[model samples]
Target: MVKTSMSHEDYLEAIVMLGGTTEVPVRSVDVANKLGVSKASVNKAISALKEQALVIQPHYGDITLTDEGYAYGSSVLGRHRMLFDFLTKAVGIPPEVAEEEACQMEHAISDASFEKWEAFVKGLDV
Candidate 1:
């Protein structure tokens, strides 16, 4: 897998969340709104994503994820969901705090460890 900065990963994830995987292309403005960033920030990140061949966009156009981009973004989003669930359901963390913490943890956790933890969580009766 290509190594990308966490910021790039966030952009990819945001794109996916905004339905970039669908036939309807996602607007850059939507991505900016989702991430609470400026349009220029989205533009800069989109440039980097284009260089990595993760997204396709024309001048002032909508964004669509390539297959690789979708897969990568889905993985990151999946990690965030899993961490959020564990934090809120098992650890009894507040939803607001868990959301923020899970976002940070999703980037730092190793794939192997996360897989094991996911399996463990699944094995639980709860």
Candidate 2:
């Protein structure tokens, strides 16, 4: 698998979020709106993802993730959710603040550290 930058990861996560539960087509505009980015930016990011074989979009068609893309996006989403929960519940941070911070921290956090943090947070409930 190709190593992705934080920006690429963000785009992948946005695509999954926009698609939600349904397998409906997710357009570039939808991804742009979700990420608050421009269409051009989305196009560029999507191109990179395509090169990595993580996403596929036909000419003027809707965007869709490949199997690898889905797995990667899900992992990123999981990290974001876990960080958000930890920041808000364990650290007593406000939801808005935690949300923003978690988004930034999710890209930088390592899997080992994240697992430890998640375990510690869950342990508090037991």
Candidate 3:
């Protein structure tokens, strides 16, 4: 997998969340709205993603994820979901706090470490 910045990962995840995996492409404006950023920011991120061949977009057109992009984005989203669940359900953190923390942790945790942690969590009775 291509190494990408955390910001780029966020953009890819946003695209997937916005249905970039489907035949229907995702609009830059929607991505901006989802990420609480400007259209210019989305444009910049899209440009970077295109450079990486992770997404396809025409001039001023909607965005669609390539297969690689979808897989990477889905992995990030999955990590976020798992971390959020652990924080909220297992640790009893507030939903809002867990959401924020999970977002940060998802980018920092190594895949190997995450896998081990997941195994540990699964082994728990509760």
Candidate 4:
């Protein structure tokens, strides 16, 4: 619950993806490339994230997530992975379609709905 827009959530997730397991610092260029957005857009998003204390970016330096950012990004990424698995593996959706749909749904889904959906997806394992 970051109380931010879906686009902001997307930026957070993109940063986490670029940073990877070691949580390495990620450059704004990398975020722009990963998101397929312009550098200006990435800068704007980064500025907002900085103001929220979610990320830290030194002047003319790479970006790194704060503890809060990592936690929130982890949740966002988990939702994405879970939905991707459920859509593609359980419901037989095409991978590309599932990826797109999951991205949209992840930001909008309520916790209660996700709880039920996750339970159903888990049931598919049985």
> Which one wins on lDDT?
3
lDDT (CA) per prediction = 0.89, 0.85, 0.91, 0.86
Q: What is the TM-score of each candidate against the true structure?
A: 0.94, 0.90, 0.95, 0.91
1 or 3, greater by lDDT: 3
Candidate 2 global lDDT: 0.85
On residues 1-126, what C-alpha lDDT tens digit does candidate 3 reach at each position? 997999999999988888788366899999999999999999999999999988999998999888889999999998898888899989999999999999999999999999998888778632
Total clashes for model 4:
0
Higher-scoring candidate on lDDT, 1 or 2:
1
Task: Return the lDDT, model 4, position 70.
Answer: 83
* RMSD list, candidates in order: 1.2, 2.0, 1.3, 1.8
> Model 4, which residues run further than 4 Å from truth?
20-23
Inter-residue clash pairs, candidate 2: none
Candidate 3 whole-model C-alpha lDDT, 0 to 1: 0.91
Clash count, predicted structure 1: 0
Ranking by lDDT: 3, 1, 4, 2
